[model samples]
Target chain A: MTLRGKAAIVSYGETPVTRARKDKGEPRLSYWEYFAWATSLALKKAGMTTKDLDGQGLAVMHPEVDHSLFLGVEVAEMLGVTSKWIITPSHGGASGCVGLAQAALAVSSGIVDRVLCVIGDAPMTYGDTMMLTEHRRDFEKPFGVMGPTSLFALVMRRHMEQYGTKVEHTGKIAVTQREHAVLNPDAVFKERFTMEDYLNSRMIAEPIRLLDTVMRVNGGSAFIVTKTEEAKRWTDKPVYLLGYGECNNYHHGSKALSDATLMGIGQASREALSMAGLEPRDMNFFQPYDDFTIAVLMQIEAAGFCEVGKGGKFIEETDLSYRGSIPLNTGGGQISAGQPGLAGGNLNLVEGVRQLRGEGEGRQIQGAKAGMVTGIGAVQYGRNVGYNSVAVLGSEL
Target chain B: MSRFGVKEGGEARKPLPYITNYSQGFWEGTKAGELRIQKCNACSHKQWIPKAACEECGSIDLSWIKSGGKGKVYSYSIIRHVVMNSMAFEKEIPYALALIDLDDGVRVVGQVVECKPEDVKIGMEVEAFFEDIGGASIFKFRPRR
Candidate 1:
């Protein structure tokens, strides 16, 4: 009943992160163009073409003018190909990873042989992000609580209060990720920063500083997934999805939700690892969504890399650099690499694939055979992320 | 439903709480200088904001019940930068917004006033107060003295 290794990710492609604007005379890309480039690059990397894709899915987390009524169909049409199944996932930041899971299901279940999982967002280039975020939220807008920064800040403060997690511990995450980013030429932020720089960074929301937040950028990433039998034809090393799990609205505003530091990632991660027949120790690396430094800290605890309420100590003792044990966000993550809207999930997901495929050059986790990529996003503004997904990937069975 | 767009003068007034028919009951209670929570009569389940059905049970027999307007600070964040309308919240530059765990067991978000931003702490006792702004009764919390 398990889809363990039934489907393999044959290739991954990502465009350089950019804030290019037509106004600044820099070349810019819409989500449409980004999707095209991302998917085509993935196919070309596998020595295949659009003709090989029998399933199509797009991850468009935020509203964009380029989005159509029928997203999957439009994506296929744009690629000038026909697909057996078309999928569009709306899991916020988890959208692209959810799309990958759906693509995996379609391929593993024999509904489709090869599926193209594409994700792109041009919020910076198009400026449609503010239009979508500002107008709605009858419940959210009035309180002067802006966006994720404000919302997550409460969670960060709660963590510090309840668990004694401190700025010194959380700031390490940004410092380590920036170090990894310095080695990644495609990373948006090239310069490395230290704990001192992190502390000195301007505070947007108390406890959540300028460095703790993910920078929004425009970019695209894609993966080509196929049944293992067909996957070998495309690449010598096909990264296999061993397991995955998702949960939403856990303990929603119930008495239990009063604890702002709580997250559903614990349940999701347990299910994924159990399905993979692996433990957290088996992962060669970890790459959870880093919309904020606190997010990565919370995931580290929820994913069982450390004990709950002990993330501070775990972070203090652990080496998070790319060359260190338990390598994390080797490609700089969304915090260091500019988050491309909800495509932020894809940035981590694709990085996991590239590392598994041994494609990570300068920032590669050496001898990395397996890793976990997690997706977390704001399903609602009230209490942390609503949807959390975990994917366990490996280079072999 | 109350008007949602920018008020006639635009940003001169504080933003109004988003009021829909589903949540009109809660707003009405707030306007009457009371804090009410949605309670499922069948399951005795308590909820916040407003929803059509009981979150715990499928009961539609939901009614507005008065809350003690007292809660403990579940969490709080000091907003140093303004992301909403500057005209509305700019002067208030750094303020403490909190998620309050109501004594009734439901959680809600409101700004914590009458205290320094740094003084806001988890488990701090607070009580709800209404702010009359732009003809809307906005619920905010202050240190319960």
Candidate 2:
């Protein structure tokens, strides 16, 4: 009943990260087109055709988007692939790992052999700003608590008050990740900025400066999951899914605000690592979601990399670059590599698979056998994130 | 309406609330200059933004109770940039939006008035105040001196 060493990711693919087509003067591709581009690349990498996919998992860009454009069945029909099993995980940022876990279960349970998990979006053409204004409480919208920036700023402010965290503490993350981005050709931001630049950046929301936020880009990412035994037939290096756990701390029936400092990643990581029979120290690299730098800090603390409320010190003392003791976001993460709507959530997972598969050309961690990736989902009424999903990947079973 | 910003001329075009059946009581209470939240009669657990059933103990028997309108600031953010296209908040840049932990054990989000954004701090005592904007009573908070 466990996912440990049962299913393995054989291939990962993604379109080049870029500005929206409308912004870059290119013909805009519909969501389905982008999905196909990424899917085709993954299938090619796996040395398989459309006929090999018997299971599919997809995630819509946002809950407010039209169902016709984001449904799993619609995507299947558009791609001309019939699947025995289909699922549309709607966990927002956590959809990437959550979908992977679901697909692993399907593959392990003998329901399907290969499952293609893909997500893509055209935020620029589809009025992405409107999606931010939807699904909030009746009282929160009136006060301009609309987007993740403002909501995450609230969490950052609380962390500062409780733990004496400074702008410099969070700034270190941006600085370190940007250094990693310099080595990544696919990253949107190639040029590097110093800590002074980050500290001096204009404030988008108090405690969260302009540099602390993620820029929305246009792209898609995908991967194929199959049984570990069958994976050997496709590729020489197959990244195994060791363990995964997902949790929703605050929902309709729960309290509006939990401790903003300690997110649900704590429990999710505990379950994931326990299932894998591993600990934080066993991870060669960490790919905690970076929708905001504070999120990464919270995940680092919640995932047991460091003590709660000591994230500021952890960032200050640790070397997070590719060659550091604890490498992080070696592909620059969403902070430096532009966030491409829901697809941005998959960046960490894709990078983890590549590093484990020995495909990291320049930024590969030496002998990286195991890695961890985490995702944070929807913001709940500017109080806290609703979902947390964590997964552990290893080079071998 | 009580102005929180230094520069003032245009009417605030903040997005208004679309009241739902579960939230009508809360909005009605704001208009009447009272802070009302839901209290589970079975478990005595209080909650904000009225709900059909109690979040704690899953009891259907709930009652509306008027809160004391006084609490300490749990956390806050100063919005320096106005990203929303709404012109209503154009002049209200650099405002402090706070999460106030109500004395009734419920948290409410509102703008802090009568003080500069930098002056607001966590755990600062605050009291609720209402402003009638275009026939809608909007709730805000002011630092307690």
Candidate 3:
């Protein structure tokens, strides 16, 4: 009934992160191509081929793409693999972790032996801006409630009012993550930024500056999940899925429930940690989704890293750098590394897996045995994220 | 000037929500200067933004009821820069967007007009006001004085 310790991620892969491809001169891949490239890399690393995959899960790339073929069926046909179980998750930023959790269930339930979960997107290629406004196209767009920046701005402002959180606290996250990005060769923005620079950045939405938001870029990431008993046959360094949880408290455009300060990540985190038989302190590192710095702060509080309304203080007093006390987003998160459309959530999930596998070359947390990754999705009423997913991963079973 | 030149008679080009059958009542109510929200008869739960069935008790028996339209500002944001490239809102550099928890217990999102962006704050009392833009009734909020 529970996926805990039953499935393991044997290998993971990612295409190079890039801003855009103006022409063939650049080494940018298409949305589908990025998925293929990452899948091939993961399969190779797992010492297997597409033929070995009996289950597949993919995240829908963009809304403009033709859904007549259905992403799930298209991917299976393109990969030349016949999957008995297939799904195309569309939970926005939470799709990656949601897909991974679903795949874990599929493999653990004896429905499939090997499951491949992938998410990728070329936002620059598709000209995809924050698409959450599409939820209520007419109602939100006319009023200029356009993107995630404004939505998160509202959340940040509310947080400030209730908790006395200031820009300095969030600036700390941006500054610290920039520092982490310097050590990550794959990071899009490797240049370090100071708190002053973050504070001085142009405001995209009031209470949310440019530095606090994630950059839209082109990339894809993937991982292979299999039964824990069969994981040893693929790789020696397998990261087991300790536990996972997902929650969608409200549907898009629904205003029945409104709590800007609470992103519903607490429920998901609590469920995951309880299932994993772990506590917040048990995490050697954290990879909370970082579409915005405020999101990370809220998740930290919701996940019980600190008490509610104390996230700002926690950020101020805690060290989030790679070698710091609480290693966070060691790969610079989506803020510095660039968000690849719906694949943004994978940026956190994959980084957690890599750290647990001892693969973080420069930003490795010493003796990291477990890590927590989180994802947020679907802005409610074009204001706040309403869905959350969290997973606990461990290096040892 | 209409709040940062965002609206000018009928020349403002902005995206508008298409009036569908399920939402026609809400739109019509706005045009008539009345705030309407769906109420589930089974559990008496109020809903906003118009949906097919009751979100609370999963009942399709719902009725459109007039709302008091008076509530406190639950949260708010000020748009310093426009994310969407709409000509109508391009010049609206700073506008207050607010979430209001209606007296009927349903939250609604609307722009806060007739006030400076900085004047908006959480817990501030507000009331819904309908604005007619090019034949479309768009609901907005204003600080209750």
Interface RMSD of each: 2.4, 2.0, 1.8
Candidate 1 residue A271 Cα shift, in angstroms, is 1.0
Tell me the TM-score of model 3.
Answer: 0.93
- List runs of model 1 lying over 4 Å from the truth: A22-24, A54-66, A130-136, A252-257, A379-382, B1-13, B84-87
TM-score of each: 0.94, 0.94, 0.93
Prediction 1 TM-score vs. true: 0.94
Tens digits of per-residue lDDT for model 2 on B1-145?
3332222553555666677676678779989999888988998988875678887788999888899999999899998877634446657777898888888788888889899999999999999988875546778999886
| Backbone clash tally (model 2) | 1
Fraction of native A-B contacts kept, per candidate: 0.59, 0.56, 0.66
Candidate 2: residue A377 Cα off by (Å): 0.7
Ranking by DockQ: 3, 1, 2
- Order of candidate numbers by TM-score, starting with the best: 1, 2, 3
lDDT of each: 0.81, 0.81, 0.81
Expressed as tens digits, the lDDT of each residue in A1-397 for candidate 3 is 7888999999988888777766746665667887788889888988888877744443333322223347777777788877888877777788778878888888788887778888667767766444334346766776667466777887788889989998999999898888888998998999987888888899878889999998888888888888899999998999998989887763434448555687678888899999999999999998999999999898889899999999999998998888877888999999998887777778889999999889999888999999899988877773457679999999998
- Give the top-scoring candidate (DockQ): 3
What are the DockQ scores of the candidates, in order? 0.54, 0.52, 0.57
Q: Candidate 3's residue-wise lDDT over B53-75, tens digit each?
A: 99888999988999988988888
Q: At residue B34, give the lDDT of candidate 3.
A: 94
DockQ of 3: 0.57
